[model samples]
Target: MLSRTIIRSPGRTFSTSTAMLNRCIIYTQNGDPAQVIRAITYPKLPSPPPNTVNLKFLLSPINPADVNTIEGVYPSKPSPTSNIAASGLGSQDKPVFVGGNEGLAQVVEVGEGVKGLKKDDWVVMDRPQLGTWSTSRNVPFHGVIKLPATGLTEAHGATMTVNPTTAYNMLDGFVKLQEGDWVIQNGANSAVGQLVIQIAKNRGLSTINFVRSRDDMGPLVDHLKSLGATKILTYDDLNDKSLRGKIKEWTGGKDIRLALNCVGGEPTTAISKLLGQDAHLVSYGAMSKKPLSLPTSLHIFKNLTSHGFWQTNWSKTHSRTQKEELIAKLADMMKENKIRAPEHTIVNISAQESDEEATAKIRDVFAKLAEGKFGKKVLLKLEDTAT
Candidate 1:
């Protein structure tokens, strides 16, 4: 939970000014990731305290990490709040922390003490957690950022949190690659994978991307090549005895210094085996749901270093200026068509659906995602007038 402290400022005490109104998604008991889609009524919001702001969500994406939270596996937990004046069905009940990590919104109202924001301005939360899935939110002014006017769509803005940032930071965070240094990553068709390819291309770095060997491998490879990936391979290549030799031949036996792994287990070991001496392997995800197993040979002979990354943890250490600058650069790339938003399959969750039905639907999607059947990103659209 985030620590709260009171700041001394002369003003009227903040209090609820309007009738309580909010429709939110919640999960009290967690088992399967899909079992978590219960809805609850929100209490009326109080008028913003001097330095607070109220925002209406325009859009938000449902990423894999969000699904992990539902499965009760994520490191962060939503903080529960009390319901004081609930009005909808089950309103006379306990409080629940809203679930979701990011969104794009518009400022509808601001407190008297607010100076940098106003009504109708587009903005996004800098630290969205456990509540962005709702129609509206009251956040501290410091947590809000004014969106750039560079034609960034609501969908793009909604997705501004995880995938794009991961792509940017992962490539830029590790060792500096020259114009032709080769970078490799599994899950090459993933949202982050695609972005990595494009960003690397823009920076003049080469990429060798790996995806599963499916019937559609040809088209997937072509698509990545179109995004400037220099080489594409599949999981089958991992077991091919001649694969490392092929990579050596492809790069004229030049040393490859960096590898990105989202898939763990044997795939991670394969990547490590392919790295040059003193190379870096950055693991940002455990998509395989399996522990990462390393080979003793690579550690003793290859002189490779393994590092783990979590975007939420990274955000804590990064300065505000660094965060904003990275976003601004990504926005520029999008405006110039140097980078593209991930393809998404939006699933609408309505206020009308029964609890059982909604939970089943979310669960089914999670199952498919776990099986690696979804060809694109998954998003849950909350049916709200503000959305």
Candidate 2:
């Protein structure tokens, strides 16, 4: 069972207070990873707009995009808000802005005009701008998706926003794949890739997954296969021409209709070469940080389609109803054991913690991630009571 706790502001220890308090992580100037994040405490919350709900965050996953935002490369920028109340020495001014894009929250209070949600409802919002890294948020009710209560833990709910949604949208959006249709993707062991394999299996699609050689490839391959991957290959196999023949045989010589590339460069080119004519290749990330180069023959003769996908763009253009439908489907799949949450390591950024401690912890994690040493997703568990 998962441990649960209510977080309150440190000031609560000094006196009996009724005001809602929130603690947030912010970055003002972007440069090195260490200089970016600072922990700020707020004494009170701003009055919610009409038809809005105030939410207490339960969990927020720290994603690569969050790191990119701190480095000032990401497109979305946090805007200043006066909603945060005064804290101690820096209490008079609102904090720069809290830093997370995706999280799972519970509605603790609703504005008078808000209708669809009430206290104690599980919800998620696209308040990436307001920041999900904080202990609480005030967002329009329409922006929130109410999740089913039973069998879902706060960690699963919090981590649901990015990876799972990205996986679902990528698989469902680009192709018209049918049962037994073969799809190929790199980064098979990644959180998104794992979800893709599970979703594909649920839809009866076949998958050809690729991963880098690692000490735990056995466990990773077993995990993907358990999720219904048809075959698993490593980057080393892409260099061997014979593997292409093996892929062809496994795919029954049927054209691989979709190729999902998270790692670019030669690996991407290899996947492109394997695609049958009129196949689609979608690039959602560049983990390798190398530019993708494709030969002219594949483009000219194969009639292949190459697309770049950003989940942020998809979220903006898609309707709430459509997004909710996808979430509902995923939740049902979880209930039926068709999908499972990705493995993750949790870092609790409790409101009462010291800034140095939080900063040091985050910095170390970022370093590990940059070094490719961290294997699972890192999540920040926020607390909200008086905090």
> Tens digits of per-residue lDDT for model 1 on 1-387?
222233222321112223335556665555665555565555545667789887767567777667767677788776664432343332325545566887777776899789779876667667747377765678888786776754676677778767788888888888888887889899888788888999999999888888888886778877899899998888888899988888998878889998999888888788778899888899888778789988877878988789998888888898988887877887778767788767878777665665456557766877888788887776666543211
Instruction: Give the lDDT of residue 284 in candidate 1.
Output: 85
Q: List lDDT for all candidates, in order.
A: 0.74, 0.78
Question: Which residue ranges in model 2 land beyond 4 Å of their true spot?
Answer: 1-20, 86-95, 384-387
| lDDT per residue (tens digit) for residues 8-93 in model 2 | 43221111224545677776567656566776666556657789987777788888888888888898776665565544333335
Provide TM-scores for the models.
0.84, 0.89
- lDDT value, candidate 1, whole model: 0.74
For candidate 1, report its TM-score.
Answer: 0.84
* Candidate 1: stretches off by over 4 Å: 1-21, 41-46, 83-93, 128-130, 349-374, 383-387
